[model samples]
Target: MGTDWVEEGSPSSSSVVKTKRLMEGLLLQGKNSAIQLQLLLKNSQDGSDGSGSSSEELLGKILGSFAQGLSLLGSCSESASAGHDRRVSPSSGESGESKRRLNLKDRRGPHKRSKASQTWVKVSSTGEDNHAWRKYGQKMILNSKYPRSYFRCTHKYDQGCKAAKQVQRMEDDPQMFQVTYIGVHTCWDIMKTPRMLIADPDTCVDECFPIKQELREDAKSDLTNDNVPSADFFLITGLGSSDQPNGPASVSSERMGFDDANGDHAVPTMYPFGDVANSHGLEIDSLSFDGDFSFDESEFLASDEVIELRN
Candidate 1:
């Protein structure tokens, strides 16, 4: 039975081949449609409307193509599994034994293909996407100066999330990054509530004064004594100070924990209070000094004291 299935004239072999070809065709079609959709979106964003077709129509077509491709892919997987089972099913007689052995051989050398779906997007910053990613690896391409960083979902092991992405800077525009997302997030680890800064006020004082490290000890002492007012203390301890005793210090890509050597740009890591971190884009609400300061939303946003502080 297994031998018959492996034969050129066999229905199973022919069907598998046809299915594989169909899947390839569908994959190509899906890729083309995705590219077209991306172009349309870019055009729309740039305020350049196309003449003939509307974005809604093109979007509908792309969605239909993707849905059809996914259905076909699932069907192909089922067919392959069924064929494998039939080839290895228990049977009687010497021919059956031989067929089982042949099936085992086939299983050892079974055809494999990558079925993971991918999406590519160009963005100004990689960390703008709120999903926590664990950096896995980095590789330098043949003709590229910057190295591409590979990151997987932080909950990959804990929640079985299979989401992964590759981040690489564009050659022409180092400020822009090309991010390629592979696989959908299986883990529903969405952060709904806005993360609040809730740390000891003393510790906040110590961490807040990064500009002058020497002032930290005094700040901590002052915080313990309750000698300095919260607002005045923040202002005095380099919250929005433009002038520095040694030199003017500015937040660079390196300061933000980004790999400047690899052409990575600075991205805001922490958001202000009351702003829920979405999976799509980054938004900030209120500024915090080591999670100790909780000021009014208007005052926080209005003040120039809002600065990215390292934890």
Candidate 2:
């Protein structure tokens, strides 16, 4: 009962292999850069060892982080190699017989090749797409002044979203970043209306912000007739927790409880950008702070139930 659905550009693709090799080369380059930085730091400290001053301390911190990055790069290289072997090994012998059949079968029927469009955008650092992405990995790249940051859909684990992208700072424009997106978002498209969004186990948020952190846990708000969550609802994260300085926010169907009289938990709430947060750190604003990032914000604004920022 195996499926032959190969990823858009698995190790089997020569292009992907070339890209991997390029990435590895970049990792090595980064390691070398780190080593050079350490040497420079050592030379600077030749006259005065253990100054313990702010400059020396800063250099030490930078060098230590670089060393850690080099080690992680070594592990990443090995993992990539191991994954490649796993993907190509079976095709080498009789063990691949069933796999071949499955791949062929997967290519047919519902498993047909997908037309997921891949797009790239050039922008400044901290750039963000319309959707929420969770920072997963950061790697040193070859010849680039800035390290590459890897991000995947925030819903990857929660809603089975597989969209991912890589961001690299441009050498010419250090303040700018290059974002390469891979995979179309199979999840809901912002879900302005409950009818437009298929409710799932995932706590829905606007395309702009995702419900990443639990802001409140014990602080319960009485669900009066007006405050009750019904079919369409969204959740907000990143604001200070209700329990801490911000504390944790909780939902109570009655006056102070987790669920309603029927045992239903509270529906999630959405965060409005500009007024509360800075586009969820997307840095989409052109005017910088004291301004707002413009996108299809109207979608989220249209939803009345999703905009209850403060309880």
Candidate 3:
């Protein structure tokens, strides 16, 4: 390296001298490697034996390695010269890096904040506004498991709305996402629904159910004022312990009304032994036959279930 230094137009004094010496050393290595290959080839020519041919092949690989090293040195020398020629212009407004940053700024355009932002809340739905949003960007958050996605009003560019939002998955629950909003939407963006057309009650009954005119008039009369039921509407079941009726009734007139098997009107059929307990297959021997009917919900349910299953 001390004897092989050649002067070149490299910028740094130390680097220029070191690079020239490095190229010379690599060139010398290549020359020596080539001489070794020539000697091996002579040995191969003397004898066509396995050992002689193997030595030639091995020497050829050594020469190839030296050639690669020389090529690397040549590249370094060219790069050094090119870098020395590259210098900042005195008359230019900015460096190449600053010009590149300006171009990038132009490409990015501008971001304007909202004029008014009064309300903010955390909600569970993506369709929070009912006003549509458009996704803009997604970036990986530092030291966080999930990436955050950015959104803005769909009318941001067209209508000049400045609203922006960032939605990110919560750390504790990956299924839940937290959204942060930056601005309020000023655009008149909303959902449109079909108008509700209500029909008159008389027309609805005429078209839907198609009731007869007489029946429709009777319905209207019944709904206009409360329809009072007759004496037959009151039924008696001997509930005498803790519960009391709204008003007392004569024992003879307090009989329950029962619908006949074949008709709709009340038939007042007499139960077996004048006691309704026998209808449930239960007989009270101690109580008289004229006693009131005692209803048991459990017994009634079980009896209905059995009858239903049998049918």
Candidate 4:
């Protein structure tokens, strides 16, 4: 999944070039891994020593390295591409490539957003043309290694807030995205409820992070065997206006619990746009999502067809 970071740069990042490099790397590593596994499996098959074969161990190491290399490749082209490697190797014959057919459909499109981009804007809710949105789909991209999810504005019926976001999984870290938000939506309700800003982080966000931790632990096993970080990494953000021209409104803080099966580490709950932007040195009070600024209710209501279609 960490490999998907490069998918953010896929438009300009040549999938052919990167895939070839990765294929060559994986082939070499895979060959070595297979050999090691074969030795270990042969030993196990012989049923000799009480110590079981280490085939699974070798295979796990090989896959982890393969995923890490792909992630590094994707991270290199983060700005130019969506970090998605969509191209299939023409050299791989159909007979042997069927099982490894590079799934390009999961790659990010030209205008899509990736979690790596790290840019988000808060929409104002005071406008009359405010729209609504709903999440439609989410998918995991192969090769580059993260899943991408889709969202569409509900106001498309009449308000036409063609806003969408492409949720790209972090190949190196399943819990993070390469998250690219595409159009600006006037929907006030888009952020009303705290949504799974990203899909299952345990299966996704923590993917690469756990691998890294394991790798680090392996390097330190000679000195210590603790499998957790020494210090916790936590980021806290607060939102609301200090000046009470309208008095202080009781604000409710939403906590998102990201579960990880690996138990490597915990990612703190990320706040919605409501509280997040304010803490990021941005003015949250000035933003609005209302859509009625340009027209009167009578005129808006007169367009019954538009209302009906939107409704």
lDDT of 2 by residue, 1-311 (tens): 00011132234556444543543454344334434444554666787553435434443343233223222322333233333312333333445457667555433433322222223233434555446788989999887678999887776545455467678877887766666655434354343323212332121222222111121222223211111222132323222222222322221110111234533344323222222222112221321211222223455445432222222
lDDT values for all models: 0.37, 0.37, 0.36, 0.34
Give the number of the best model, judged by lDDT.
Answer: 1
Clash count per candidate: 0, 15, 0, 55
lDDT of 2: 0.37
- After superposition, candidate 1 runs with Cα above 4 Å error: 1-114, 190-311
Better of 1 and 4 by TM-score: 1
Model 3 poorest 10 in a row by lDDT: 194-203
What are the runs in model 4 whose C-alpha is more than 4 Å off? 1-23, 50-57, 76-79, 82-311
Give lDDT: candidate 3, residue 131: 45
TM for every model, in the order presented, reads: 0.28, 0.28, 0.27, 0.25
